[model samples]
Target: MVVGATGTTGSRVVARLSAAGLRVKATSRHATPVDGARPVRFDWNDPSSFDNALEGTDRIYLVPPPGSPDPAAVMLPFLRQARAAGIRRAVLLSASAIPLGGPAIGQVHKALPDLVPQWAVLRPSWFMQNFSGNHVHARTIRADGTIRTATGEGRVGFVDAEDIAAVAVHALTDAQAPNTDLIITGPQAVSYGDIAAVLTEVTGHTVTHRRLTHESLRDRLAADLPIEFATMLADLDRAIAKGAEDRTTDTVQRLTGHPPRDFRAFAEREMRRPRSRPV
Candidate 1:
């Protein structure tokens, strides 16, 4: 069972699991269908949806909702429900910055060991999907050839969502490892400038990373997000600027037996279409 099946990473997990001929149940808030899979309704706001989603499932792909203030409050109860429903194995989608007791998904990680027999927490770096998915800053970058962020010249090891899905499939299906945190990343660490260069090469336009103050970023995002969320994002940018996300890791290659895709390759693939200024 894959929670958040309609999401960027969850959809990939559902597809890969189904392609491998695994018995898969995919969950979506709406009735979005996954080919050759059964669709189940799952809303984080509703607790009753938890039991039905976990019924008779042995393995689950879990992704908590974004910006959830109390992830443990929501997830711990669901995990207990999953355990009671006989779900044993779980692959949790966590973030690179969140440690066992850290903020956000850390609450889930810290609680999982007591509830499930086997599990894997994927602590992956910034996703390449932020470029093509719903990330407003990345979309702005693609359109305007400029990415404005408070993160100034800090390098990040951005991993592809496909690679993350692949690793999740391995952990869910195979029986090699359990109860561990996997810090996955791209093969190389590069600055946002390097990312822009790659995009420029692929799109034939000069995309660049522009530094901004935290206050400016907060102001820019104030219209679309709550003040707290905007502040958190701006603070995260400050953390990134401090080289918090600079290091590269080998967990992807170690688990998948292939080197993780680089940012250049990801940019080349994503920028295949024409580019224009932001409308």
Candidate 2:
């Protein structure tokens, strides 16, 4: 089962699993159609939708409720139900900043090992898609040639979603489960300014990184998101500024036998894709 089947990493995982000829149940709120896989309706807030999605599935890919400050409140009940339904393995999509028992999805990460016989948690660094895909950074870049953030001179091993999914596939399909959290990252550590320069080069338009204060960024995001979630995101940027995400690892290369895609290559590839309007 692939939860959040329409999302960034989830969609890629579904495609990869289908291409590999694995039987997959793609779950979303609407039972949306996904090519080469079965579509099942599953809502995070609705426990009634859980049983049908769990039927006959031994492995599951979990995507936590996006933007929810307290995802454990909704996710834990379904996870317990999944355990009772005979699902043996689970792969959770988490973030680099969130460690086991830290906050939000971290609560799930801390509880996963005891809930399932086999499990792996992916703690990937910031995504490169934030600048090239349909994200706030991409939207801002396209609208006014600027990318805004609170990360001041802080560098991140920004990873590509494709690489993240590849590692996820390995975790899901390997006969032996990783049974640990993997810190996935790209090959290089770069700042937002560096990312802006790369976007300028790949998109044929000048782009600039605009740094803002933590308070300012929080206020900006709170306009559209919950206050607590906005505060957490802003705090993550503050943590980055302090060099929390400054390191890179060989997890991707070791597992996939291919070097993770660097930011420049990711930008160029996305620009070359059809209908890639934003860099």
Residue-by-residue lDDT tens digits, candidate 2, 135-191: 999899889999999999999999999999999999999999999999999999999
Rate residue 203 of model 2 by lDDT.
80
**Candidate 1 lDDT over residue span 95-178, tens digit each:** 887889777688889888888999999999988878776687578875787888898988888999999998898888877645
Cα lDDT over the full model 1: 0.84
List the candidates' TM-scores in order: 0.93, 0.97
The lDDT per prediction is 0.84, 0.94
